[model samples]
Target: MEEQRAPGQWWRYGPPWSRYGPPWRGGPDEAEPQHGNRRPWRSTALLTAFVLIGSNFAAHDQPHRVPLDPYARVLLLITSLLLLWRHRYPVPVAFGTATLTLGYLAAGYPYGPVFLVVAVACYSAVVAGHRRAAWASMGLLWTGHALVALWLYRWLPPAGDTRAGLTQEIVIATWVLAIVALSELARVRREQWARERADRAQAARRRADEERLRIARELHDVLAHSISVINVQAGMGLALLDSDPEQARAALTTIKAASKEALGEVRQVLDTLRASGAAPRTPAPGLDRLPELVEQAAAAGLTVEVEGEQPPLPPGADLAAFRIVQEALTNVVRHSGSRHARVVFAHDGDALRLRIDDDGPATGADAGGSGNGLAGMRERAAALGGTIEAGPRPDGGFRVLAVLPSRLKEDQ
Candidate 1:
């Protein structure tokens, strides 16, 4: 039996941490909540940036007496402004902020707040799919820090505190850089895993659709002919009851046989649909069963003729050929408006060919354009990587030919 799966639940098989596996795009519930979450987070980031800028201003208030460097404050203001657009344009924002940080370092300004901005910018770069930019920016930021340490050594030489030496500052700055680099690496892994999970989810959905289509085709092939026969037999039996008692009895018996066949096929279809453990019935009608198929169509009042030497075929080629014949014959019964049809299955070395020709009027009041039967035959042939041609024969008949690969038939 087929496994029971809930609709839209196929993504559950992907990695557990994959938040993107769920169908969030254009989903009503997720859209509003995602918007709400982003708005608040953006507001908080803006508040943090302003608060930091405010703190920097408060500390540097005694500007006139000390003659604070206006250029240094301007660079700091630019870095603060870059933070506002970091989430929206992370790579460009990181570049702008890093440029300002380098300028501040060159101007011999303190590295405290500008360093925080650089670290936040790195986070945004990783989240925004700018991993290479994030790494390059990290290297640049570290170089700037080393320059800062050198400037500090030259201007405010280390006092009694031995920890303020070149090696110590380099080591501390390297550790901070490593922390940022590692965080970006983790973010990249998370993004890759999320993408993989989403792909697997989509694949699962496609598989489900294929399975449903296969079941539909099988059910169509298995039950359609038998049910049609039953319908014909029941009507014939009802009409011939009093006048032709023996013929009526024969019609009733035909209905019983057709109904019994339908019941068995329907059970197989239902078993396939349910999740219960049921193996499919072995050996569905295929090319090997073509003789029996022709005989049955003959019994249905169509004169079928077998043609060309038989050829060995792979399972799918065999099955597709059989179905092409079955569907063709069924079409003959439904639309041909004539009693005679011919079925030909020929095997070439590399390919198997099936052709059904019926000596029926192609156009008239009784002959509507060949309906679903022709369409179904074409679909079956195409599914097997084969080609089918169906149209009016030159000699006032309808004909179909399907050429299928012998070896690659079942591969599809």
Candidate 2:
């Protein structure tokens, strides 16, 4: 269920119907209506202007060979006044105006611009999405106008002036139809714009989700690899504490180095979260740091041989490739029984290829049936429009290979 907002709380953010709000509240949905409680002064002002203009015309020129009387003038004023609440109660206002218009027409007075009020009311109804009510009111208005025109032509008009009355009726009918058509077109355009906004909002949310997933994968790879090395070193240190003091001291040193590196990387991740707009304190770990990663793996009893020629890569692809290598080596150290591994990096025109082969058992965790490390590597590769292949080699070893595009299409 959707959460209900507190009463009067919207005023603190902005007007009740305004889009602006506190950052925590989330943005308003463009597809939803924004009907504020405050009086619609603009509509009131326009109606006031129309009433003044209509009154001036009623006082001077007579329409339909009939002069305006006090009763007809009162009805015209009442119809215009009803429009002040058109936005709040569009159907009621429209009905009220239509009733007053018919009364004015039937009173044997001039057609003193009562149709202007009815037209405005009809437009308000349509804008408020009350299409059926607007159409019904329009029908009632046209029917009333036609009946009044026929009555005038038959009884009130001079015999030779019948053609003039008919022409007046035709003009009024055209005006009413034009107003209805324009209002309907406006409603359709508004609906189309709202739909387009909704689609764009959905697409933005999907992109944000993908970006968050990518960042999570990077954090996972960094933590897993560093912790694995620390765990291994700490275990060796504890085992050699009494029997071989020097060996134990050396293990403790490795543990300290690994923990320090882990802390720095963790700080980098935290910085990324805290200050997205600020420059990073340290650049993301990329191909340049591959040697340090290998050294760390070596200290954890994994003899890793590095072979690669560095090539220029987009920042995203560079970081992803480095993470892929880090995750693969970490898996070898944690799951593979063998201690020797070889990492080969090669550039192939538009793509950067990575191959990590380990002389480990064919059937092991690192052989890549299903593990988070392998999954993370695959995600990184695929995000950069690349692919990963991991399985047990035929010669009783495990191999992980990744090929990443040096420049992503989005980057281009």
In terms of lDDT, the best-performing candidate is: 2
192-233: candidate 1 lDDT, tens digit per residue: 999999999999999898777666666676565655555556
- Provide TM-scores for the models: 0.60, 0.77
lDDT of 1 at 315: 76
Q: How displaced is residue 326 in candidate 2, in Å?
A: 0.3
Residue-wise C-alpha lDDT for candidate 2, range 32-125, written one tens digit per residue: 2454644454566677677757766775765545566566567667778777678779999988888777766655556655677888899989
Predicted structure 2, TM vs. truth = 0.77
* lDDT of residue 14 for candidate 1: 24
Alpha-carbon shift of residue 106 in model 1 (angstroms): 15
Report every candidate's CA lDDT: 0.66, 0.78
Native-to-model Cα distance after best TM-score fit, residue 65 in candidate 2, in Å:
5.9
Q: Which candidate is the best by TM-score?
A: 2
Clashes of each: 1, 0
Any runs in candidate 1 off by more than 4 Å, and if so which? Answer: 1-181, 273-278, 295-299, 362-375, 407-412
